[model samples]
Target: METEDMNTDRVRHVLTSLMILSFLIFGGLSAIILITDTPLTTSSVSLPFAFLFVSAMTLIVTGQIDERPKLTKKYLRQWILVCVFMVLVAALAFTLA
Candidate 1:
């Protein structure tokens, strides 16, 4: 029942999901490193946090917001808070590093 355009869109979605998964893996590894003996540098933590946040935002834009109304302003406000929180957390991570 699906057409060529549907298949292309599915492939794009799958590709984006793979990219996002990789970012999440990296972020989780960074967290694990921070928790373990070596500890994580400011950049170490920042890089992962930034990547994860960006990946999530991009997925939201590409899969939902631009094409649908799956998100709300209140949710967006919370997401912004999450971004700000990452900055503050990174700063603390730096001091601890």
Candidate 2:
């Protein structure tokens, strides 16, 4: 039981670390886009915004899982859906760009 708990802790730590890194990167990109003088277009700004959204969602999921470690699977499923949404957003951005 102790080992299982430790493993889950480690997994959660790794997940949160990755999410933080992604959030920083995506947030930076979004900030850069917003800071620019160029006019914002759907194609020009959608991908970074989408990434920022997904990163935020993942952070939320990580928090939920941290509160109830047993719900890891449920949060993971949500993470997968968020990833799919990211891909779709990327495709749409490309099409529009």
Top candidate when judged by TM-score against the true structure = 2
Instruction: Count backbone clashes in candidate 1.
Output: 0
For candidate 1, lDDT tens digit of each residue in 12-90?
Answer: 5764785578487767877677678555557566657666765675465455433533343444456558667775786
Model 2 has an lDDT value of 0.77
Question: What is the Cα-based lDDT of residue 17 in candidate 1?
Answer: 81
State the TM-score for model 1. 0.42
The Cα RMSD of model 2 versus the native structure comes to: 2.2
Clashes of 2: 0
Q: Model 2 reaches what TM-score against the true structure?
A: 0.76
lDDT of 2 by residue, 16-70 (tens): 7877787787788777777886568777677676666766777787788789888
Off by over 4 Å in 1: 1-4, 37-40, 64-97
Model number with the top lDDT = 2
For each of the candidates, the C-alpha root-mean-square deviation to the true structure, in angstroms, is 7.3, 2.2
